[model samples]
Target: MSHAFLKIYNNKRNKNFFYKKQIIYIKNIIQLLIIICIMHNFWMEWNNFKKNKNISISHIIINGKKHYSNDEYIKKTISKILTTNNFFKLNLTIIKQHIKLIPWIQKIKIHKYWPNILKIYLTEYEPYAKWNENSFINKNGDIFILPKIYLEKTVNLTFFGPLNSQLKILTMYHTMQNELKKYNFFIYSIRMSRRESWQLILTNTIELKIGTKDIKKRLNRFIKIYPILKKKNKKHIKYIDLRYTNGVAVG
Candidate 1:
């Protein structure tokens, strides 16, 4: 073929290839726009479904052992949120935050039933003993505060200790109570001084002075001698000093 003919053929082929590429790009853009429109419509429908009044929560069932807190108080706490929000869109985190504001509530579990029911399972702290003046200690050694109205119903055993010593004091109280119970002696109060010294007041108002070191050993020794002391005018005993290395000193 002639050189001029070959150049013209090449130019025409290149233009056809460019046109095909542009067509493919335009098709891809159209497909992308179609996908975006479908997603936008789906999102709008989803939002409308969530906001529909038919799915709004109508019944809330609270199941738990109520001690200091009643169902009425809990219902009142989350009433505003429950009234305004849809069940499908209700946030469990928000509900948990509201319930936690009540001091008596220890742990909570929330579940949403299909359609319009919300169930909440609650666990309240069991007050095992009174701590210091204003707080109570649970069986798990956790300290919590309660309203003045509920304080009157608190356990008779009172524990006094420094800050951050709740677990230590609570554990000691349990150990001492177990040992004392064998002798029919019940502890009314326990106090831990700044120096870490321990003291106990029995139900009969008899005081026990337990020094800082070797507390368990000293207590064991005292327990061994308690029966003999009871035989000798126990009513006259005001305080028993168990800090000695050999025998206890009774006052």
Candidate 2:
């Protein structure tokens, strides 16, 4: 009788343990379901907020303008549609793309001030170097092909290179400027070679051949020798080869 009673007691304990486990598992499942429902509700609310286009763009903000006349037309166009409400849809990539049509704008940030206002911030591109055949390049390497009228109004450095040659050309131009500061010689234009070497043309039409490596020492050598050579040679030399480890060879 004692052994049979003990067996029954052990079975009850085992069943209670399983019951407790099941209760805990159900509680966890309920918590997960509640969290999922809350997330779904939040997503739905966000969708409604995007669809609420009743509030139109009350104002347009512009920053970093070099010349006002060139960008006035762009601002006028934006102002026309600026009053239209409900443009910010859930997948409204079309409206976002239309903002880039502004000629002088380099980048834009779109946001909502809420209740009754929309805000747009635009950053205008400044010319870093002159592109080939009448264009301009920004500091970020973006090329802007505008009318010749814009070019005539401003002076920028001429930079020329093939598709893969931009990095090398930009580096060489900067290096030349740094070394030639003592001689007051700044590079007017940079032309790249097929072999990846750089040919720098200075203000006085002085041509310099800078190889792919050892730029500083080569330029320093030229700076030391250029004044002395210029005084001796009354005739304008064609080119100066600074690639040599010894003294520069002038022709």
Clashes of each: 0, 1
Candidate 1 segments exceeding 4 Å error:
1-55, 224-235, 244-251
Report the lDDT tens digits of candidate 1 across residue range 199-237. 999998989999898987887887888778979864778
User: Which of the numbered candidates is closest to the native, going by highest TM-score?
Assistant: 1
| TM-score attained by model 1 | 0.70
Clashing pairs in 1: none
lDDT of 1 at 177: 88
Each prediction's RMSD to truth: 9.0, 11.2
With candidate 1 superimposed using the best TM-score fit, by how many Å does residue 121's alpha carbon deviate from the native?
1.3
lDDT by residue for model 2 (1-251), tens: 99999999999999999999999999999999999999999999888777764656554444444452344565565554555544443222433466677565667666656544555556767777886647777766777655567786665578887775655666767777887876798887888767767777788788888786787788887888888998999999778998887978788
